[model samples]
Target: MLRTRRVGRGLSMAVCAVLTFSFFTACSRNKTGSSDSITVGVVLPITGREGKPGQYQREGIELAIKQINQNGGILVKDLDKKLPIKEVFYDDTSDQAKSAAFAERAMSSDNVVAVVGAYSTALGEAESVMPDRYQVPWITTGAAASTIFNHGYQYAFGTLSPTNLLGSTTAEYLGTLVDQRKLTKGLKLALALENTDHGVDYGNGIKEWIQQHPGYFVVVFSENFDLGSPDFSGLLQKVKSANADIFLADAHLQDYITMHRQYLQSGMRHLMISYGARGPESDARKALGDGVDYIFAGIWWSRNLPYPQVKKFNEDYKAFTGHEPDSWYPATAYDAMRALAKAIENAGTLNKTAIRDALRKVQLNDSLLPGQTLKFGANGQINTPFVIVQNKPGGKVDIVFPKDAATGDSIAPTPKH
Candidate 1:
């Protein structure tokens, strides 16, 4: 009888041990499934000098996220589960110090796998330090300074074309206008740029291009002005006095709108060209009207691309924002999120290091930019083509340069008001 009782007790103990182990295994699996949701962070200047572009960029990111979640979320390989992505965004307010602080906080506290933002070059410079320290991949859609990539950090990626390429593309398109339309011979060019890294990069790019094609361009005046200068009369007068045939100004949207209005009021009538951050903001058009006509800008993307992907994006964007997408700001941010999604899918894991490594290898097949496929270099910089857009009468914008990708004929010498 004693032996029989002992045997029964031992059998019960074994069964309890097996049951406990099985319960824990099930719980562990459930816990991992719960943690599979991926989180991404965005930092943008939603309140200051960079506010307009920031809003555009945020819209793009939101759109991409919507699409991703609608399509059944990101696939996690290790767990064999599909997880939705969660986005956390902060407004940098266009302040450099604030941008840096936000970036640090996002990386450390929010525990984001990747970060996207810093619209201005100054803001980018400030926020870049956090990515390097934390090993989180940082992608910027607005900032275009080459120095950002030159930092030797593998985590920094810029979807927009560098200012150097923008400058050259602008000069090239202008030269075409001069040659084809016989608008001006030996066109004297003047550059009035905001005094910042963006300005310096654009100015240097134009100088390099002019040196390479000397007879085509003659730079009569080159000057840098404060970003928020209220009165551009003095600068416009100098440009007018120089007799420059083409005036190139690199400025942010607000400054672009302000100075261009002032430039018109000052009666300076050279073929106006603004690169880097200029675009067709409704406010600018409402304020300047025909004055903005014929103004050319070199930018990352254009609504004029006839590709189906681009058309869909444009239509969706207009539906959401009640405004057409601008060239650089929104498109780049949209691509950044899509690219991040691709990296996560390819890595099959949420491990930061794996995603970072996979990001380098990820290639986007359905990009909105015409004739531009998305691929990252070792330094995380994207090599993409740019478009030159001319603001036409009746508020029409047409992509003029790069004949192969142009959607409409070039409007040269702009219509006289």
Candidate 2:
């Protein structure tokens, strides 16, 4: 999966990130905290549409705990003892109210000082408010919508990048194709996005990029579709009739799968295709087979990154899960657990306010993100970049953006049916 191609503004940053990403730890002696195991709560969609990614996140958190406990656990300054993490979580089952309710219960009855869970913007936003309400520090592992952090919440932090960037990055990459003469300028584009803050941000980002770089692309069709819509035939038919040269869609996992099936069946061919954060998923590739080939996506994690840490983690992750990783879902959750441990160690006490303060100022170098460093900004969101991945022929997934870190070149004007 490691092929090199440099595109967009992604390569050099990834190059620099590779240089900086390292397994970093803090050496501090502490006491007055829990002498036994520390409790951290998790709330993730385990049985719903978001369940697959949630399961990956859960594995990531659990694996991190196993690794940390094996070493000596986190040292508490006041207690003068190292403590292992004890995770208490409920399957949110992808329900909004349940996510918040489970988060509340975990903090109240489960005795969790902090939480490192929740996936997708909808559920993450639902659980986010409870953290501040309970004075608990919640770090989102999967949510990326900037709106979650825009409300001036102090106790919520996230490891995912912003959605606006997801769209902007995808468009910029397409511009590179035009620059390379692989794609023609003034191409008609169709925009299909989910009806949520995540989708709106993506649409705005793409529009902003197109505005800044005139003559590269023109929006011919745009529509908002609900998540989990069973029939995309009507929408696909519209897209087919639009005579668009490229298609950009923002959807979740299930939507991506459902819509792509309809897209392939509709026989609508585009020079390029993107599914926001939805393409390059393992299940999509398996379900659609070669139909997904050459499809590009703005993704959080790709094993194709030219980093030894990613490679090592991939191997360890497979060993822990007994299955290959579908995407980068686990890394953020793994980093979230590490971040929490670091904050707890630095805080020197189990005090929630102190830990929240610690979280705001915390920085971890050995992160699974493209930027190689995990630090939250004023919005409690990690300002990270993303990689554009292409599902190549022969079941291959490669990073084609940030040419410096790209594992392969993108194939445009995908073969027509």
Best by TM-score: 2
Tens-digit per-residue lDDT, 1-417, candidate 2: 234444434688887676655321111112223348888898998898899999999999998889989989988888888888887878999999999999998876666889889899999989888888889999999998878988999899998888898888999999999999999999999999898889999999999999999999999999999998899999888988899999999999999999999998877889999889877787987788888888889888887777777888889999999987677899889989999899999998878899999999999987877978889898899888989888888888889997987988888878774
Off by over 4 Å in 1: 1-34
Candidate 1 matches the true fold with a TM-score of 0.89
> Model 1: which ten-residue window has the lowest total lDDT?
27-36
lDDT of 1 by residue, 1-417 (tens): 999999999999999999999998776565444475777889998888889889889999988988899898999898798888888889988898889998888887777888987788888889887887998888887788888888898778878777887788787777776778646667788899889888988888888887887788888899999988788888888888999877889988878888888887776676556645476566678888878887877888887776889889999888888988865578889988999999989999888888888889999988876465888877777768778877778988877778887767776555556
Candidate models: Cα lDDT each: 0.81, 0.87
Candidate 1 lDDT (Cα, 0 to 1): 0.81
lDDT of 1 at 137: 83
TM-score of each: 0.89, 0.90
